[model samples]
Target: MPAPPPPSAAVPRRRWQSRLSPTLVRDRCYTRSFHSAGLRPAAVPLPDGAVVHLWLPPTAATGANPLHPVLLLHGFGATATWQWAPFLRPLLAAGLAPYVPDLIFFGASASPAADRSPAYQAACIAAAMTALPSAPQRYAVVGVSYGGFVAYHLAHAFPEAVERLVLIAAGVCLEEADLAAGLFAVEDIAEAASLLLPQRPEDLRRLVGLTFCRPPRFMPSCFIRDYIRVMCTENVKEKTELLYVLINGRKLSDLPKISQQTLIIWGEQDRVFPLELGLRLKRHLGDTSELIVVKDAGHAINREKPAELCRLIKNYIVDPSVKYRDDRKGSWKNAIKRFVGSSLRKVDSSRPLL
Candidate 1:
């Protein structure tokens, strides 16, 4: 018997600990939730050596009794699964089939192409949809934060395919000058990238503080480090490039509004993009858009108020006639009252016929 060989020095103790990390456990829960919602993981390959990893319904491939399709694009901080897991079950329950994809360089999705613009991301997604068997001819799109930028481009580039749009805490209306104009807390794009793509525990903490109205009371440093290791370290260079591309020279005048009716949900307390950006987007989209402000919520509205967010999404997607108060002027409460009252009226009017 060869006595005890020396323990391999290559693997650090931290690496061993990460194998049993709580973050991993939570990620497994997210996976289970996705599976329970009848979504399966797949990779849709594009001609440009990019692979988009998606969670598709069983019906997407077979086209049997297909529900309305809704494409979910995730934000910059984490992969599709991490950002959109809370949305899966709620969306499925609302009779909307979710097509959740990890944008390039995130999760299992990757592209070797040099292009990093949102338009490129949109093109990849559009191509993937076209290539998928029995894909929906038209579908709704929901984008959050960074995902909103991509979703906007997708709708603009393929209006025929995108029937409706929803943007949550996405600052697609922001101009490149906004950063220097004191719109954001960060002084410049590099600072924004550092916070968004945190490499250290403190950086993650700052991001969480800005993102959540009430961040975790006690997030241990070890867990933060573990999260950064698992979620933030994979594509640092590319993600940094993406951040620069997103804000470097963007201008509001350059943004093209889509014909699709849009729903803009923002957190009243959002510190990242700020609520003003949501209002700007509504103004840009004009009568085709409605804005909803979730009181007390912050940038991560999906996580902070998942139930409310889901309700808004279901109402907007399931019923084409659903409309909120005009963007001209209305308090949040008034808008909610009008929305609820109209929904009640519709239900009452249909009850007798049913």
Candidate 2:
């Protein structure tokens, strides 16, 4: 016989925990600079041996309200600079204190020849995050393109550590040959690596056209092109190899354990990964997750629609209705979430949405 469920059974929350999360603890502990000076860049230590290149923005510099602490992870073969430079202003305008980091193999972060596996990469990211100084250790992670793959893995690997997740133009779960080939489409690896390197203005312009809904004509030719000269790369071989490894890496079957709310951002015209992957991810993640597809955009959703993207993030930050919040932390509520979770486990597993 089925027993009656509690009034708060629909709400999901930890059975025995205070709302004063680790983030609150961190805020009480760390002496924040609060944008006392300009943007500060540093090499932060991770639990693993790798050091991550991080940019801590001035908290109050933009003359706006205090924002949430955000961690922005860039795509493959690119440095953290790629994220901080273009979108940092938008993020700041939205009242988000952005923390941009260069993954081990990509930016100024030291990556030894031996450090290669995707699991190791994810672990390193978690370790680096655990070491950062923030008011709340729980932060919103925004991963773009290749970085999006890592973002999902990171949230799954370290569930309690992440508060929310934002995936932009991430890749497919399947290991396709063409997908691997496309990653290396960049013109040069060495030039893509160094900040001092230069790229053609026209290439940037074209890229912007392919990425945004209503991008400026000069965007691709000017900003992106100038930026790419020093930033864009042709990291074909190793990046392809990394994708091969990550594609076969692991699946998020235990995603239900992740309490963080997830936001999927996709570009409708992004032929690289395509919209289906994002749509599939939303379902697999859970019903609480949301997906926002940008029209007339390509693989680079953030780069193409920075303002719109910023608005979406801000809305997410303000609205809790679309999030994964377990309102009641009572034992009865916990019992229901767990019971339903376990009962549906077998049935839902058999029902394939894809």
Candidate 3:
């Protein structure tokens, strides 16, 4: 009763057990994955005093492969490592050198500048890439969710450097009015920010539920608390500012369509940024872009459908001519069957099977 037994002496056994963080364990696994894929972490300091942290290929200087340098940009919630670790080995197997970066205000990357626009993020990324030793003249960019916004702006800002584009579950076509019109479950940007940058365990759970089509069966409360403490607690003000700048007052009319051949991948069951936005983006890009809907996935397609996503990216980036029909309603194979059957009725019956 008197002073509650000094602070350190009163620590509970359960509290001590919670200190063995699952978040830190998973983070170590992510680091191991990156290292196994031959990627080493580096920090690139910009002229504006911001430092961009990246996982760079082993052959960055001497034996760099100019033809297959690919930049991977992650979304909100976690660092680039957590979002992109699953992709490294597959990309390397396809002979593509993957460069993964943590965008400003997330992970180890941070900027001192006041500008929080996606365009500024894009410029910082471009500058970091340019500063690399023996940097490739051109590289394909693969952006997921919020990363897609930055990727789109990067392509728009540096057309000469970005050769191809891949956007997954990104709502670049979304406008501020869409929020007012109820395109999202959240009522407004403030609610959205709270959900994204969660401060409480329940909020993190809610975010995970919205992000994954099949959320994990069980997540320990301690793990959630540890995650929120380690991942979501830092740079809180700056991260919130980034979110406000991303969604506030944005307009489709002001969005520029990139000239690069684009591959847009969306989750069929995405609730965060609906499939309607993906279709709108395709229509806005006209013939320059192709839309592919990953079946049975939600907002977290990278986690939910990593194999399929990697396959799509590899096929598109390695050879753009390898076309994949949109599988929105059904499989592309069924579409081919329908097309072939329709064409057969108009053909001569005497035609040979050969």
Candidate 4:
């Protein structure tokens, strides 16, 4: 039998974890943001001993011609709240029933099982979403950074259920060769993991610099220390394991087999994965995928350019006829349809769903 889900308590913050800290304040704001967007928080238990905490619109997906279901998955560092808060209102207004889930070991979700692979994370989320009171027969997914890895697996695992797939700055096709080629600044996987899951304030600073195009010139050490203590401290072991599992023991050929109408969005100036990987992924995904490069942006493009991102997403999924300009000077560049041409046959893989 699976272990029970973890508890999420709302307790007062200690001096070291002050309420005034930006992280806490932003979290509070995200809560209000969700409420204002017609969404409320909920949780469901998965068979694999993990409880998934997600925020869904009050009007759940139901009935014939129901509102389209959209699942937004967040990456590392911050939980779903911080990463996805900007998208809630925009997507909801566009007639999408958005569901933002904190992957296992993030936010209110937790798992006692030793598994930390993206595949397991995808399975757990699939189970929780399907167990919803009014689950949709099909849904769309948008994942950024690490969440892109989970999204890729989720779409691959449930191809029939996922109607559309979107990956933003997700290096799903990265290989061991990319690391050796010095495509990333880190010396090795361990060094990359350390930088991403920083323990010290200085490490956190380095991470921020890499994540943002224009990181704050001066962040108070107190806030850095507090943020690190609150956000980057928990699930250290499991997160590190996740990093290894995602990067190592995998080849380029292992790229997820997905057939959903796909959209690949990337920051042209992305340092972590770089723009080259995005182009490579476009080639790998074949004609069904479209690539959009957000110019002058970095790895954290979702936060840096939320409105433009939302516009692109809205047009792609909601209203293709309603063309929106890439206000950030970004351009929509569809794939050149190199692999086997646009006549490629769809490939399907079978996996159990909740």
Candidate 5:
């Protein structure tokens, strides 16, 4: 809206070797729509004595043309204000209606109270939602990054409430030791991995690699820095509350039980949560769910490829059949395209890749 507050820092460029392909160029169109239309924030009270920072649809919302309130959930360290802005315009344009809320510990939401836990946070989100007054009865959700993990649990944990599910860079659980080393630590991913998930390394390493189709050299330092800030900003007084939320937020074993319609999208060239993971998630979710790998998306598709993502999102919610088929066909097309592009570029640059 208002000229973006000057970027916290210059955006880091991908080494020529780490560039995205032409097909991944879905929505490079840029506009100032969202800056002028940001919604006012509201407070959502929870049963556990916590308060969440939420932005509600205009109360003057018209019933004859009321938009469905889309609840957007944030990632592990992100706030509502920081995470959902990129997708807001498309959501608004789609006319499905959307609401962005920061969980208790992350955004403007108050820090955790005595009973805070991941389940407690989830319950708080559920409770805050019940207080909203929007209609046209479409219960659609879109979660970004780690928020995707919560969306998964939310859909499964409260199946009757949500009608559609949108997972962006959705996260899954690992034994800690299984996580990828590149995902954490300000300087050294391996060292950070060892410290954060000492007991479960392999799973974490694989998970981190899955985020990207290919990892970049000299990784985006600025993103990593901002990421560190988000993680560190947690209400320190509620350490246990934040920790609990991180450790137990997702449970993939329960994915098959969710009856809500689901849609999954990832940047095909994403090094954060690779396309293969999206493929596996597709099979596990079955024919009812849809998955698309945003051609050149990294972990932040809304920021990098906002236009295409926005269009896909709008179609996914308003035109269900179209999105479902697009997703089914899209993932396959994008992956093959990414593979070919990588091979060509690798050959041209004389870069070594797997």
Candidate 6:
């Protein structure tokens, strides 16, 4: 791919945080990562009139291979760029075009409609892909946390358009009873909502503590407050509704009837969704499904263990022979062993045995 445009021309300036702020520097790095991967920003308007801003890989990134579209959906809290930055280059290198969409009410995406259900969110994403010029006949979706709910609904709503499904730390099968039973670290749904949709520094810190297995001990209150102001303050009502509809509106029985090949990835120490939910989802998805858990990680495995997540996703999407055992008690060592072994078998028939 050609060299990225100069910083001034390529990335728009944001004046909210000083350039020296850790957060702003990290944001710049994320944007640079996207540009390095040949992902340029674009926007699409959904049928419901909501607009989605995305970073899409350039034609050159896909090389000479026939286009294989893949959708990367971010969960609640942050934009698609923040969550999927690490995976873009790898997917592009693996000859897959990545479409990273910011869900409605997040980032540059917005829906004026009052509907906040997962199905509605899913529909908006499906419409975006369909609107793409020469849309892929079938695409794969990888969703993290709340995005997984959207992904599940997307597969169910448009199975004909989806070839594979990957759920990361998404608790699609959790029932209201699980919340009542203290399955989550929070006391109740209200507390959970408050933490997830935190408007205060303390609440944001709580969220970080739950999200990361090893969260930073001393994030400046000013940074947390600023992050909440810039990222978490938008569409607060609709976001809350999205959470409510997801946790209260669905049950295990209502899980989407997705027939596509599925992969369930979880963070072993995830406090938000817990590993049990991932195992349950794998079993519910039946024989065609596989579960891989990242050890020493938490709910934000995409951020905590990005390389492993990217490799697993790229392998599953590009390699037809990749096989993942259904292990509910998976660890990092086992996952590495399995992934390396699988990758080896694809190239070297006489490779050393694991």
Report, for all candidates in order, the number of backbone clashes.
0, 18, 0, 0, 27, 0
lDDT of 2 at 305: 71
lDDT of 3 by residue, 1-354 (tens): 556666676577546655587877788899999988888888999999999999888778455565688999999777889999988888888888888999999889999899999999999999999998878889999999889999999999999999999999889988888765656766578888888889998888877887778889899998888888878899988888888999888899989878999988888767778767777898899778877877788888888999889988988898867656444444423323433533221122121100
Q: In terms of TM-score, which candidate is strongest?
A: 1
Model 4 — which ten-residue stretch has the worst lDDT?
A: 345-354
lDDT-wise, the better of 3 and 5 is: 3
Q: Per-residue CA lDDT of candidate 4, range 1-354, in tens?
A: 976544433243254356568877878888888888778788998776789999876677333344777889998777888987888777877888888899998999999889879999999999998898877778889989899989999999988778888899988888776665556777478988888888888878877777777767998898888788778889898888988888886688977668877888987667777666677787788777877888667888987889888988777778533333344444344323332243212222110000
- Every candidate's CA RMSD: 9.4, 19.9, 9.3, 8.9, 10.9, 10.8
- Estimate candidate 6's alpha-carbon lDDT, on a 0 to 1 scale: 0.76
| Tens digit of per-residue lDDT, candidate 2, span 189-245 | 332222112245544444444344565643423335334533445443445456545
Q: Evaluated with lDDT, which candidate comes out highest?
A: 3
Alpha carbon deviation, residue 345, candidate 2 (Å): 33
At residue 238, candidate 3 shows an lDDT of 88
**Residue-by-residue lDDT tens digits, candidate 6, 1-354:** 999778786455444335646666777788898888787777888766788777766862344334667889998877887887877777878888888888888878888898888889899888877776646768899898889989999999899998898888888888877654556665455666788889999888777877888888889888887687667787887888877777774478867568888888888777778666776787688777888887888888888888888878887888746776434447434654544433211112121100
lDDT of 3 at 308: 88
lDDT of 4 at 301: 90
* Cα displacement (Å) at residue 212, model 3: 1.2
The segments of candidate 3 whose C-alpha lies over 4 angstroms from its true place after superposition are: 1-19, 325-354
TM-score attained by model 5: 0.66
lDDT of 4 at 124: 92
Off by over 4 Å in 6: 1-22, 60-66, 325-354
